[model samples]
Target: MNSEFSYRLLPGLLPYYAFRVCTKFLQSQDLILPGVIIGFLANGFNIFSNWLFIFQFELGVNGAPWATSLTRAIQFIFMILYLLWRKDSLADTWPSFSLRKLSYNVVKPFLTLAFSGMFSFAAEAWSFEVTTILAGLLGTIALDSHTITLNIATFIYLSFPFAVGIATSIKVGQLIGEGKAADARRSAIVAYGVNFAVQITLIAIVWPCSRLIASLFSKDEEIVDLVASLIPLSCIFMLGDAVQANTGGALRGLGRQKLVLLLNILGFWLLAVPFGAVLAFATNIGVRGLWWGFTVGLYSAAFIGILFLVFRVNWEKEAFKAQRRIAQTSQ
Candidate 1:
């Protein structure tokens, strides 16, 4: 079983890498609609493929991940088709493939941003992986419940907030590069508003349909019940996730990813995980306690990003710095 799982994982990464390449290119170009359309299409394809593989072919247990991998590959393929059909947009950017002059002076700043961005994102993601480990300590049922609830939350998150955050990043960077500080700040506000509204709508749906939602993932009564119970907590955490995603987008645009990095580590590791460990082991709260702890981390961690963007930042000064970066990069 272990060897089979590992083998399947190898195939999974290929589609994931392809999806990343296409979506990242689209986002970098500020072409939000193409990426969003591709995402919805991929998810729809995933559903169809899963049904085909699992029930139609009797592939059973391994069908879902395989379906997912196929969908990811399809997404990139669809993207390539879109680019080919819409020759004008790609043509504008791909007029020629050229990597302008390279130097340590030119490369160092980008390397700094890349490392900081990578670590900041990795820390939060790894912290969540630790929660999965902690849930396993409670036994199979708890782990199953945690996995289902997380999958649901992730689906909702990626559906909207993720896209909004990317748009926020691209828009802010563009406005700042143009030396329009106030407009960049306004763009940040609009992004926050959109994310907040979308998340609230999702929470309202999830809170009432918790059981129905849980049933979609599993049939076992215990797992379904546990997931329903966890769904509310997931909604609570969703609040934090929305805030963090939105503000983090702006921070990434601002090039303050190191600050984002420190806050996530402190919030998730120091505050959330420890609190959850104590609650889960010391009290009768059990697996739900772990989620409560994550909730704390999400809200607390996101607040710092808010503070930096709202209270601390000088908009005009930021614009000047962005202009300077642009000038340097262009040179």
Candidate 2:
């Protein structure tokens, strides 16, 4: 499974990158619904392919990534087709390519921001990936619980808070572009209102029906028991995640990815992963140790993040800087 998971992940990387690029471009254009619909189609196909390859074909572990790769490829193709269909609408942004446009001065700032944003996301993501690896080391039962809980948390993050974050970033960017820093600040507040709304809704679903939720993922009684035990921790983890996502989104709108990268490193690496590893390996607390460690780090980071947004950030100044940068770039 190790070798298979490793190599299998490779085939999907390029397609996933392509899909992400297309989706982001669409998002920036305020064409999010297209990407969402395409994503749904791809995921729907992925589920069917997983069933076909894993169950009907009886290929087991080997079949899963193949299904994923195919789905990713389909998604990229669909996104490309969507762009082609909208060629006329995108023409202004897709001016003819020119060799003289490829200067370092033009690309450097973009690359810096892009890379900072990339690493900011990767830092948090990799911590969970690390947890998954550690779970594998603990044994099959532990891995099962970790996998199910992680998936549930990820699903909720992506479906709700993450979406709110993206919308907040877009709204803030629009407000800043219009030189309305006060409006952007208000938009951020509105986003938090939405974020907590969804979080409450999520807690309602995950708390009382935890065992039922676990059973949805796995039928084995032992796995169900273990996953249910992790749900309370996951609920707490989601709150921190929601706050982090909200703060992170606002910073991105301010073009402050460097600060975001710093925070993620301080939280996930300096705090979460190391502490979780110690709790998991140095103690008898087992998988829950890692879970608690992550919760602590996330909550700590989120607290600091919210504080920074409230006290440190100067929205009017950020908007002025952004307008200056835009004016300079246009020249």
Candidate 3:
């Protein structure tokens, strides 16, 4: 088994994983910063609250797990309270206690979320997962270097998606709400522009310091060697990453979850994973092969995601009209 298996698994990991997944809901609704503070504080509180278990019983590393769980629980609780208090922002527009309403309110949003939010995460995660697997097959130093590059790329990527989500969520929601087709189109363009500007700035900052950042993860000569060789690829990878995420956000705003899901599966599973596996194991391409796969898949997803957004405009309008008809019938 992998060294990190227990890190991703274990009963204690669930709450934190759930918090990460559910936080997107808050983000799409514009509550992330406050939620993060509450989450961090909750974690701090959990450590304090569970200090008795650590000190009195000496549970060792296990006590840390309990502390993490307590944090997630408290974070979830706070989020629930916040949502309930801000009922207008969080509530379903039409109310009913029936199963049908539940399906519409919770199930649909969740299904959309699974594809748009979770599936996208899965695509990105699998890219890293496969990298880890491939690196393991190669050697430990290769694995260390791969992990280093992946972490830096991830940190750099965190900026674009949140900004993209802001534009996509608010503008698309408003456009759909008011039947403004031109505005919907403009919003997508605007999101892309914003993502482009921000991502370019990040690339400029990191590209020159790429080796410096990579060196931070490890001091081993072999690991550092691998990282230095991969820095350029990592920079390219970041651009593709930005495009993929922001385009996915645009689709999410357009409510095209199925399309987004299909695009991700095709891009990552069909194209990236298989090719990377072949090059990483069957050939002598090494760690860079894994990143090459990442670049290909991300670029493919970005292109396809953009195409999906373009085609989805009419469908989005139709969805709005259909909802309007339902409302008219009820009236």
Candidate 4:
């Protein structure tokens, strides 16, 4: 329901939006459009490759993941090559494998990302695992229904985070490079706004035809019924999902990934999963109780991500300064 939901929209688009705002600030549009075009192609390359793998291989559900991973590797290689060739665009982008510098700059960030990503992965993985286990306890029918609804929900979950990744990578990278604190704040705002608008629009479009969406994953009538019943909750889950994913990405851009990881750990491990266990196993809410636990966890992480960002302003400045000092010292 929030407006200007940029973060939940598309990560690729955020760079373009940031460029537009940044160019306006500098009164230059000539390079902005071209840069955005290149960025679009850059993003589209992997997407196109993914489609080719899927369509060509008939990879269906599982094929998509492999295709995506392969395409991402290709994309990474392409970006590396492009950056190498276009050295001017990447001002000192490469890093030396020095222990001292690595310890100070890259190691903590990498570990933070590892933990944060694991926690993020855990949020859903824990719920899905719980659902499967509980479903087994309930009977094959309940398990099938749970699986059907979850697969559909999983597809839906992919959209918001992709958008968030792009927004954070672009906006944060630009702000750090140009030292635009005010615009960095605006970038976060714009991301949240665009994300809200896009997601709400998506929900409206998807809500009326929830059954149709559910049917894509399975053909079982009873499962379809369960899926239909759960569509509203799935939509609700995505709202919190939007907040957690994009906000996490924003924090990453601001170099507070460690805090995000910690929040994720506490939100999912200590709070959401435990609450879900109590609700699903100990209460009468049935499988729906499990989902409620997932929802609670997502909302909790989202709230923590926002709070983390709010308190991270000075930290962002300091991170940039530290990076600059390192770069200067290296020179």
User: Highest lDDT, which number?
Assistant: 2
Alpha-carbon lDDT, every model: 0.85, 0.88, 0.70, 0.65
Give the alpha carbon lDDT tens digit for every residue of 156-273 in model 4: 6676655565566457646765667677777777788778777788778777888897787678887777777777777887777777767876776665656676777676777767
Q: 5-71 in candidate 1: lDDT tens per residue?
A: 5565566687678667666666677777887788888888889999998899898867777787778
After best superposition, candidate 1 residue 99: deviation in angstroms?
A: 6.8
TM-score of each: 0.86, 0.89, 0.78, 0.69
Q: By summed lDDT, which 10 consecutive residues of candidate 3 come out lowest?
A: 1-10
lDDT of 3 at 289: 83
Candidate achieving the largest TM-score? 2
Residues 1-331, candidate 2, lDDT per residue (tens digit)?
7897678868888989988987877777678899889988998999999999899999898889888988988889998898899999998775456655566665777899999999999998998999999988999999999999999999999989998998888888778877899999999999998899889898987889999999998999989999999998899889988988898898898888998899899888888888888998899977887888889888888888889889998989988988887766555
Q: In model 2, which runs have C-alpha deviations exceeding 4 angstroms?
A: 5-12, 48-61, 136-139, 218-222, 281-284
Superposed model 4: Cα runs more than 4 Å off: 1-91, 94-127, 315-331
Q: Deviation in angstroms for 238 in model 4? A: 0.4
CA error at residue 42 for candidate 1, angstroms? 4.0
What's the residue-level lDDT of 305 in candidate 4? Answer: 75
Q: Could you give the candidate ranking by TM-score, starting with the highest? A: 2, 1, 3, 4
CA error at residue 138 for candidate 4, angstroms: 2.7
Positional deviation of residue 106's Cα in model 1 after best superposition, in angstroms = 3.3
Model 3 steric clash pairs: none
